[model samples]
Target: MKDRLASGVSIALLAALVAGTWWAADYAKRAVKEDPPRRLTHEIDSFVEQFVMVRSDEHGMPMTRMEGDRLEHYPDDDSSEVTQFRAVSQRTERPTMTATSQHARMDQDGARVVMRGDVQLRRLAGQGRPELDIRSEEVTLLPDEDVAYTDLPATVVNGTTRIQGRGMRYDNVSRELKVNEQTRVQIVPGSTRPAAPSARQPSKG
Candidate 1:
């Protein structure tokens, strides 16, 4: 009788251990399945110094500039750069132009920049329009690409032209303007009406 009782107790304990082990395994598997993947983060030791940007011009005079720190370039997303950030000093200069602005984010793939908080652009030489003063929540810049657009409407004063548009895209490569909905472009001393290019008939040589 005593042997039978001892055997019964041992069986109960073994069964309990197996049941507990199975429950713990199921819980761990469920936890892993419900969790999301993590993003990649790289720790930057220090910022870059004197990053230069250059573009070829029609006159053979390429635009060149040396931009200082607080400037970060992330190869992943070409959409934003932290310019003139409070953490570091930033500066940009060119032969024909020198401009300064605070808080800039440039995209990696696309030719776009989001300048924030007291943004300014200037031309050192050429016309009397020495500077472009802009105050906006955000300003998009496609400098050489001439393809800048914003989600929110912006007030821009570039040289003699003042433009108020919901969004604007200028293709420097093609020299064309892609105005978004409710766009208002005013060329100083010129009419605001859209011009139709003269149609040409095909000619046989």
Candidate 2:
């Protein structure tokens, strides 16, 4: 009877150990399944710059010239010192965007870029004269659409024209600008004004 009781106790202990091991393994599996996947991060060791010149057949010649500087691209964080950026179209229309403290944070998939800081943008006329100047706090650049926009209040100056708005969108590809919310346009004095209409002729007697 003593030997039998000891054998029974040993079997019970073995069964408990097996059950505990199985429970631990199941818990680990559940934890692994519920945990979120990790995102990959790639750090940039040094600053880099890129300069690109774009040409198109529409002009039957070279169309645009672009230069950028002090760009640091990372997988998840923002780049630093994107100091200079300029684009010149075929008609000699040059548009430039720069920042004193520029940083671009890219999406994890690298589909979009968000630019922040003391952002200033300018558009030049065909004569290389400053036509437009824009200041904003934050801007986003969508490469797929070749567009840039900002939600912060902005001041835009184009030659004799000055405008202020709460938000703005610029189409880099189409060369169009749209301003939103409380837009005001002011034309500088001495700028060319529309000609006045002539008085009607007197009726014949």
Candidate 3:
């Protein structure tokens, strides 16, 4: 009877030792594990300099191209900003257009670009379309739609004729330029609008 009791006691102590060892191992694992960190609202995800990105249309044609000296992306806001930025639009219905700005903000999956600080936009002469140029303090560009607008003082030139306005919206699809208020008009009398190409069109850059 005494021998049986001694054996039982030994078995109980062994079980407790195993249980304590298991618990200690689990505690060690949990103490060393760490949780993932949460991102802040303004946290930046990426940054680059002399960056270039090109986007294509559904038809596999290059639709928009963006280039900049510096680019920054914020994952929290799902937006991007660029310094010394330039963008080019290549749409089938319109001539290739280029825009330059000291600063640019891109949003909504790059469908919209807001350009600031000495914005200049130009459309290369092509397909019988004369060269068009615009200079403004700021301009909003929609690359997919080939549209641009500005509410600040702006100057637009077609050939030798220049028009100054406080605000304007240009739609490449409709081939219309709407001005909110006309400020001035300058024309060189001897110079005429560039004649549309005949059978041969000028090559565009």
Which candidate gets the maximum TM-score versus the true structure? 3
lDDT of 3 by residue, 4-87 (tens): 999999999999999999999999999897777985687678999899989898978888899999999998878899999999
Local distance difference test, each candidate: 0.47, 0.57, 0.82
Candidate 1 residue lDDT tens string, 107-164: 6443445667764433333333234433345556665643334555655555555556
| TM-score ranking, best first | 3, 2, 1
Q: Count the backbone clashes (under 3 Å) in each candidate.
A: 12, 2, 0
Whose lDDT is higher: candidate 1's or candidate 3's? Answer: 3
Comparison by TM-score, 2 against 3, better one:
3
Ranking by lDDT: 3, 2, 1
Where does the lowest 10-residue lDDT sum fall in candidate 1? 196-205
lDDT for 198 in candidate 3 is: 19
Cα TM-score per model: 0.42, 0.49, 0.73
RMSD in angstroms, candidate 3? Answer: 7.2
Tens digits of per-residue lDDT for model 2 on 73-153?
Answer: 554454433445444443333343332225555453333556667766655444444455667888776544456678889
**In candidate 2, which residue ranges exceed 4 Å CA deviation?**
1-101, 108-111, 127-130, 193-205
